[model samples]
Target: MKQKVAVLGAGSWGTALAKTLVENGHDVMIWGNHEKQIDEINEHHTNTHYLPDVKLPEALKGTLDLAACIADADAVLFVVPTKATREVAAKFAAVCQNKPVVIHASKGLEKDTHKRISVVLAEEIPADKRQDIVVLSGPSHAEEVAVRDVTTITAASENLASAEYVQSLFSNEYFRIYTNQDVIGVETGAALKNIIALGAGALHGLGFGDNAKAAIMTRGLAEISRLGVAMGADPLTFIGLSGVGDLIVTCTSVHSRNWRAGDLLGKGHKLDGILENMGMIVEGVSTTRAAYELAQEMGIEMPITQAIYDVLYNDVDVDDAIRAIMLRDYKSEQEFTFN
Candidate 1:
C-alpha cells in the first residue's frame, strides 16, 4: 500500500527514517523548523548538516509548513527530541484533520513527569483525530540506517493491529521491523538505555577496560528492568530488541551522542561545553536527571543511574562518581525483585 507519511523533525534520525519510508514506496514528507535545511532537502535531495554527504531520495520532500506536510497523510512519525515532542505534537494536532496512525521514534521520558513518549503523544493528539500510538525503537542508528545498512527494530503498541501495520509500513530488505505489544517496556527501555550508554562512554573516557563496560551494561539492564517493571511493564520485554539490544549499540557505538557527551564529561569537559560542541541532543544528560528523580520517588535501587545522575546534575567529578559506584555495598547478582 502506498501511503503518505509525515515525518516530524529533520534531524539525523528523522531524515534517515524519511529516507527509509521513501525507499519503501511511500509518499514521505519531512517537516522541519529550519528553512535552510528544508530547502536543502527539497532542492538538493541532501541533508548535509545531519547526514553529511548522504544523498536523500529525490522523491522525498521537506517542508516548513506542518499543516501541508501532514495534510491527508496516512501516518505521522515524530522523531524530534524529547523536549520538543509535546510542542510539536500540539502543533500537529492543531492542523491534523483526519485520523493518522500516530507514531514516535524519539526516545526519552518527560523531564519532570517521567511519562513515556506514547503517553505524551496520547495526551496531545486528540482521540478523535488519531489511532493507537505506536513506538518504533531498537538498536539501530541513524547514520547506519541512512546508508541502508541492515537494521532491525521493534514496533510496539497496545493495539496489536496498529503495531503490525507499522511493522509492514517500515520493513524492507535492510530494515526489518518486529512487533511487540509491550509499549511500556519498549518505551522505557528505549529511553533509559541512553543513560547507561553515557556511563559506558564515561568508562571508556576514564580508560576503563571491557570489564567496567560490561559491569555497567549488565547492571544497567537490571536498573532499567526494575523501573520498567515497577511501571507495569512486562519483565520479559527487557531482554528483547528494545532493551538489552538497544543498550549494546548505544553504549558502544561512536554514533551515539549520549555516549560522546559522557566521554567528554569523563575527560573533564563541562556539560555545557560538551553539548555546545556536539550540536545534538544527548538524551542521556536529561534522562539521567529524570530517571534519577523517578527512581527516587519509586524507591528503586538504581545505583548506576544514581551515580551517573550525580555526575551529570550534582557537579560530582566523574572519578568520584565511578568510585561511589565501585564502593557501593555488595549485593547478590540476583537482587532484582520485580514489584
Candidate 2:
C-alpha cells in the first residue's frame, strides 16, 4: 500500500531515509533547502551535495517549497539537523494541510529550550492536529544505510501503537526496527551517547587503539545511565538499541560526524578548523553544553561528558583532557549508582 510521505532535509540521513521510503513503495516527496539539492533529487535522482554516488529512485521527488511538498503527504519525516529543527518545524506547521504523523530523525537537545525533540514538536504543532509523533534512532549511519548495510534502530513514541506504526514504515531485509514506548529513555540515550562518542573519538585521536575505546565505551554508559536514570528513564532502556548499541557504533564508526569532530580536535586542530572542514552540523557540539548544564542541575557526576565539554567549549587541550580523565580517582565502577 502506497502512502504519501514528506521528508524534510536533503542531507545524507534524510536522503537515505527518503530512499528507504521510496523503495518501500511510498509516494515520497523530499524537501531540500538548497535549490541545487532539490534539483538534483527531483530531476536527476541524486543529491550530489551529500551522498554523491547513490542513485535515488524516481519515485522520490524533491521540492524547495515546503508547503507544496507536504500538503498531501500522510506523514512527514523531520530529518533536518538539530539546530534547524525548530525553525523548519514552525514553517512546516504553518502551511501544513493536514496534521500527519510526524517522524523526527534528528538527535540533540535544543540549546535554548533544553527540551527534547518530541517536546519541541508538541510545542510547535498542536497535538490534536499533529496526528502521531515518533522518533527512530540507533547505530545506523547514513552512508551504510545508503549502501544497504544491516542496520537496526528503535521506533519510540508516547504510545506503543504509534511506535509500531512507524516501525512498519521502515522494516525491510536490510533495515530492522524495534518498538519501544520509553520516549525519554530513547531520546536521552540518543542525545547523551554522542557525548560519549566524543570521548571515544578523543581516545582514537590519541591512538589508544581498540582496548582503550572499548573501556571508554563501557564506562561512558555509566555516566549516560546515571543522568538518564536520575531524570526518570528506564535503566534497562540504556542497555538496549538506543543506548549502548548507538554509542558503540557512533564512537567507533568512521562515518559519525560527532566522532569525526572529536577526532579532528584530538589531532590538535582548533574548533574553528574542525567546524569549517566538516561543513555539517555536528549535533554533539551543541548538546555538550546542554548535558553539562543538565548534569549540574541534577547533581550528577559525568567525568567523560565533562571532559568532552572542556575540550570543546573551554579550549582545554585534548592531551590534557585525556590525562585528566585517566587520572580521575579510582573507585569501584558501581560505587556511585550502578550497583
Candidate 3:
C-alpha cells in the first residue's frame, strides 16, 4: 500500500512532512529549488537552511528537478510560503501530471487579493487534472514535530472519503490526524490564526503577561471567525481543530516564526532589522494585509488584526498599536455569544 509522495519546499514543515511520509513507509521525494538544499537532503539527510537542527530520514529523497519529484506521486504537499504559491504553482502546473490530491501546509491569504492558499491551488492547477485538494493544519510546530512531540492536525478535504484517506496516511502514535470537510473554514482558520499569534508574541515582548495574551487570543479568534463566516465558511468549524486548537498552539509556541518575529518587533526593533536577522517568512506580516482588507470588505470588527496590520505594514509604532488595542471601544467579553 505504499504510495508515491512529493513535498515541495524544504522548509521546516515541508522537511518534517516529507520525513513523516517516509517514516509511514511511503515513497517520498522532496523538491527544493535551491541546489544546496537538494545536496544537503540527498547527501547529509538534512535540510541545513530551514530545519537545520533536525535530521531528515534517508527515505526522503530530495531533488531540484520538479519532474523527478512529482513522478507518479499519489499526493503532493505544497509547503511554500503564501507569497510564492502562485508563481511556484505555475511552474508546478507544467510538470505535475495526472493531478494528484494536493495538500497545502502553508497558511496565508494572498496580499490584497485575499485569495486563500487553496484558491491559488485551483487557479494554478487545472481542474480536469485535479483529484482532490486537501488542507492539513493544527497546533503543529516544525521543531516539536521533528522531535516527534505528539502533534495532532486535521486533514480536511471537500470529499469525506478523500479526507479519511489523507488522514489514514499520516495518523500514528506521535502524530494524530483528524478529518474535516469544511475546506474553506479550515483554510481560513489556519491562515488567520497566525495574525493572532503575532499579536500574542508582541504582547509577550511588551512585558504583558498571559492575561493580555489570552485576551488577544480570544478576541483574535472571534475576529477570524467573523471574517470566515462572512467569507462563506461554517461558524462551528472555528471551534474545531483548524481554528481554536491551531490558534492556541501558534500563539503560545516559541517555535512560531510569526510569533517570534512579532516578539522582536515589539521590543522596538525596526521591521527590516528583525527580518534581516531572522531570515524567515513571518506569514502574519503579509497575512495581516490580506486579513485587514478582507475584514474591511466583510465589515467585521477586527481590532487585533488591524493593530497588527498597522505595526507591520502601516509603519505605526508597535507600542502605539498596543495602546490602540488596549484602548479599543470596550464591550462585553461575550459580545459574539448573544445566545
Candidate 4:
C-alpha cells in the first residue's frame, strides 16, 4: 500500500529516510524550518549541507508548511534534534488533523523535563490527532542509509500493530526494520549510547590505545545497561542493536556527529568551538547532561556518563576524569552473584 508519509525535519536522517520511503513507493513530503534546504530538496533533489553528493529521490517533496506536509498523511516521522522536538510537536499538533501513526527517529531527552522523545511527542500531540507512537532506532547512520546501504533498525511501540505497520513502511532490501515491544529499552539505549561514544572519542583524542578504548567500550556498556535497567528498560536491549549495537557504531564511526564532536573535544578543542565548527547537532553533548541528571534521580551509578558530563560541563580535566574512573572503588564486575 502506498501511503503518504510526512517526515518532519530535513536533516540528514530525515532526508535519507524520506528517500527510502520514496524508493519503497510511498509519497513522502518532508517538512523543515530551513527554506533554503527545502528549496534544494525540491528543486535540486539534494540536501547539500547534510547529505552531500547523494541525490535524493526526485519524487520526494519538501515543504516549509508543517500543516500542509502532515495534513492527510498516513504517518508522521519526527527527525529533528532533541531541543527542537517539543517546538515541532507543538506546531504539528496545532496544524495536523489526521490521526496518523506517530514515529520519531531522533534520540535524546528534553533537557530540564528529562522526558524521552516519545514523551515529548505525547505531551504535545493530542491523542485524537496521533495514533500509537513508534520509535525507529539502532546503529544505522544517515550517511550509510542515504546511499541505500544495508542497514537494520528496530521499530518499537507499546502497540505491536503500530510497530508492524512501521516495519511495513520501510522494509526494502536495503533498509530493514524489526519490531520490538520494549520502547523504553530501545529509546533509552539509543539516547544514552551517545554519551559513551563521546567518551570513546575523548579516549581516542587522548591517544589512548585499543586497550583503553576497549575498556571504555566494555565498561560503558555496563554503565549504560545499568542505567537502562534502572529506568525500566530491559537490560538485554542494551546488548541488542539499540544498546551495544548502537554504542559500537557511534563510538567508532566517523559518520557519528557525537563521536566527531567528542574527538574534537578530546583533541583539546573547547566544547563551544567544537560545536560551532561541526555545523550539526551533536546529541551526546546534551544527552550527557540529561542522562547524568536522570542517573542521579534514579540513584543509578553511571560513572562513565558522569565523567564525560563533568568534562563537558564542570571543566574537569579529561585526564583527571579518566584517572578518577580508573581508580574508583573496586567491586565484582558482575552485577549479580551466584548463591
Give the alpha carbon lDDT tens digit for every residue of 1-339 in model 4: 999999998999998999999999999999998888999999999999999999988899999998899989999999999999999999999988879999999989889988999999999999999999999999989999999899999999999999999999999999889899999999998998899899999888889988987898888888877877777887778878898889888989899988888888888999999999899999999999999999899888888999999999999989999999989888787762110
Q: Residues 1-339, candidate 3: write the lDDT tens digits.
A: 788888999888998888888888999998888887799899999776777678888777888898888878898889999999998888888887776888889999998789989889989989765688899988898878888889889998889988998898888789999999998999999999999988898888899998998788888888888888878899999999899999998999888988898888778778888878887788888888889888888778888888888888888888888788778777876776221
Error in Å for residue 79 of model 1 = 0.6
lDDT of 4: 0.91
On TM-score, the candidate that comes out on top is: 1
Cα-based TM-score, every candidate = 0.99, 0.97, 0.96, 0.98
Candidate 2: tens digits of C-alpha lDDT, residues 1-339: 678899998899999999998888888989987887788777888886678889999888999899988987888999988878888889988888687999998899989667888888888887755787899998889988998899999999878888887888888899999999888889999998888887777777777898888888888888888888887889999999999999989998888988888877777778888888897888898999998988888789988889889988898988898789889889886564443
Which model is ahead, 3 or 4, in terms of TM-score? 4
Ranking by TM-score: 1, 4, 2, 3
Candidate 3 yields a Cα-based lDDT of 0.86
Q: Which residue segments of model 1 deviate by more than 4 Å?
A: 337-339
RMSD of each: 0.9, 1.3, 1.6, 1.6
lDDT of 1 by residue, 1-339 (tens): 999999999999999999999999999999999999999999999999899989999999999999999999899999999999999999999999999999999999998988899999999988998988999999999999999999999999989999999999999999999999999999999999999999999988888989999999998999999999999999999999999999999999899998888888877889888998898898988888899999999998888899898888889899988888888887887786452
Q: Model 3: what TM-score? A: 0.96
Worst 10 residues of 3 by lDDT: 330-339
Per-candidate local distance difference test: 0.93, 0.87, 0.86, 0.91
